[model samples]
Target: MNTSAFFEKRVGWTKYTMLLVLLVISFILDLIISIPTLTTTPKLGGIRGTSSVQVPSSDRIGMERVEIGIGIGASEGCMWYGKDDRQCRYTLSFQPSSEFLHLPPKQNVTKHFPDGQIMATCHINTALQAMVTTSFIFGPFFAGLLPFTMILLPITVFMSIFSAISLLIASGQVAYHLKYSIPSFELQWGINSILPFVVVFLQLVLSIYIGTLRCMMRKKNPPPPDMTDEVRLEERPRDNTLG
Candidate 1:
């Protein structure tokens, strides 16, 4: 059985099946990365007697109090509240300190003390909405039209490109924050923030492959003859036989 013949016989169902599988996998990965997790290192400062704060996942965006742990002193734990200049303060062992500093988004904030400074790092996980939209909305939309290869192929390719670009921008934003702002913070690519980028790239590759397969199938299987032409040809053969 020739490989091309095998694919041609089933109307390129194999390609469509593979496309669906890729889209599903991509959607899952996109969804997974959208969840808030500890994408960066908890400890931020390197100086002795400096406290290291671990901002919990929940406090990244909301007005909730962020729990902080001190590496030095006998203080058990502290909590940070608010991002405003005066509101950004932490209480360590019931000792209130107003030296807490807020940095730009995706960067770690710092707390000043006489001994040393403590840093709290967190990234804005804004890609969640985009990833979710791409995965749940656009992905399924294209997958549903897979049976119509002529329509599906171009749409898939276009969607794949669009999603890939969007993901790239998101990944770049995360990486920029991780690199320049968060000191001593290490971001795990596969586990933390790089999942969407990888998934989108995979989707793009799959879309291209599906598009190629679609073109090949089209070439192999010619379009059906026009109904009127087919009818005319059939009638001419019958008329000749009768004559």
Candidate 2:
């Protein structure tokens, strides 16, 4: 007797599951770092100490717009309340970190402006995140499903690069502070230091998984396509005699 077989194919979970987990981790890390803005001012109260910068408005509801400038010999830090382009009282008169002692050539600071030191940080960060995620999220899906890449490649690359930079900016922000040298210390502790390593590790894991999967996919032979036991039996030839 002879037999033949048939095999079925389906996309598996490893590729998508790993990416989903990574996405969750990345968002968690981002939130951990970003939430600082809401807490640090009150927490440290260094330059912005217990004070806030608000944009004074004629509107009955006056928004909290207070700008605090900190320095010893030169301006070391500044904080502004929620509004942009509006004026407010200084948050603090005291300088908190040793960096104030080393004063830069001309300490000029701005709390607003899309790219102004602070605002730029948020902008750069948003832009960068938009970039990295585009790639991280779509790269494998498109490559695996469509690979007609001229369409997705540029966009993915763009997002990947931007997100990479946003990640960098976040890292940079981690090492800075409205409290001056506090960032220097944070660079050693908390989620800041751990974040970079986590990103790198996840990226590597994603890369290796993608690489291995791609190689496995391209191997061509693919065990001659899964022959099923039922099919094998169906294809078997039978000889009849009364046996």
Candidate 3:
């Protein structure tokens, strides 16, 4: 099926899939490209973490949480690093230590200094930086762009569709639409129930990463948004048929 018509005809089915593929492709492209900001390490310094924790290898893609520790310095902020070649707000871990530090002690809260969550964030963020930066650099060269729109167009279109589908599936599994249990992941709940929420947030970030690559690839000029919808009837044409 032709591309534009395929979109028009199966728009509903394609909606989520479209988003997914875009994200995957962006992640891939981000991995490929080293344009400018690939060299810097996302400044995740002095992020108080458990001094030592077991980092087990699992089928699960991102870094896994191991232990809990304390919170210290610069309570809340954002940073970007490595080469995810992805976009915006840098890394994606929730600041549990930040919150725990800020919060006053309630009855049963077990607030540990440099806890597992902190350790987990550190590992996940650093690893992700590497993955994303690598992907960004790879994307552009993988589908090299010359003046010839014919080859580029098919590559862009096909990659968009394929990557989007893959992304959707990957993200759906992350999003909890399709349930597959990871035993270790299950154990993380003892530390914090909201850990999965962090996963969803990171997945969304990955989705956005793929989208960035697609935007870089395509060419279009979208019209400005129409802004005259809220005018009152009395504001104009007060007289009947005032031609």
Candidate 4:
């Protein structure tokens, strides 16, 4: 049987095409998630008479706002509460604090704070940065392997497991930080932060399915008989006829 015809019948175009499409989507999603601007919120302080400050988006991976300060004081506008008193005007700002930027190909990070005090500490930022890096590296590579299904199967399985583990670790860290961190400020997770896990999982499943299909095709369609064997058989029949 012709190799092309066998592949067309067994593997089909749609299966691999869909796999390629999924891979591309996963790659793009990983890149988007890697950007630090995905989440932003106002950091506020104080129970009564609070002030709010907009935290800047992180420039590099693993960078986050861990501490904020708000000041409440009297302004020129007076509504009159009593004989000698003033209304409050809230002023908001972020205090200098330490941040870890876990860029790729680097392990050690430097810490700095103007006041020599650590306001908050959270390792979730580091874990998330690592997860984003992994996805960024593997997503494109997996997509590239789609044309070579035989090679892709084992690698995809490994990647799937790695990605799942990374997701769990990152998620756990985030949960821990949220639960234990400052009560006045809350960190909100954006869609970009969560999309990569879902995409990686889908890639893993598709890789397995495609790999299985390839294996079945190979089993069902054995290689064509050797030309040399057919020639020898024909020659032997002629020899017997002559003898």
The TM-score of candidate 1 is 0.37
Which regions of candidate 4 fall more than 4 Å away from where they truly are?
A: 1-6, 35-148, 182-184, 220-243
Q: Write the per-residue lDDT of candidate 3 for residues 118-157, one digit (tens) a residue.
A: 3233233334444444443343333322123222333434
Report the Cα lDDT for candidate 2: 0.37
lDDT of 4 by residue, 108-172 (tens): 11111112111111122223333433443343234332245446444544554455455445434
Q: Write the per-residue lDDT of candidate 1 for residues 28-100, one digit (tens) a residue.
A: 6544433322212213211112223343456467443332222211112232333222221221222323244
Instruction: Residues 1-243, candidate 2: write the lDDT tens digits.
Output: 111110012225554566657755654544343333323333221112222333346575765444333311001233323334212223212223223222233332222111112312323333444445555455443333323322333443344344445545433442354324322221222334245345445545654555454456455422322454565678888878769
The TM-scores, one per candidate, come to 0.37, 0.37, 0.20, 0.42
Off by over 4 Å in 2: 1-16, 27-197, 221-243
Clashes of 2: 17
Evaluate all candidate structures by whole-model CA lDDT and list the values in order: 0.38, 0.37, 0.31, 0.38
RMSD (Cα, Å) for all candidates, in order, is 13.5, 11.6, 19.7, 16.0
Q: How many clashes in each structure?
A: 0, 17, 38, 0
Q: Pick the candidate with the highest TM-score.
A: 4
Model 1 scores worst on lDDT over the 10 consecutive residues at 116-125
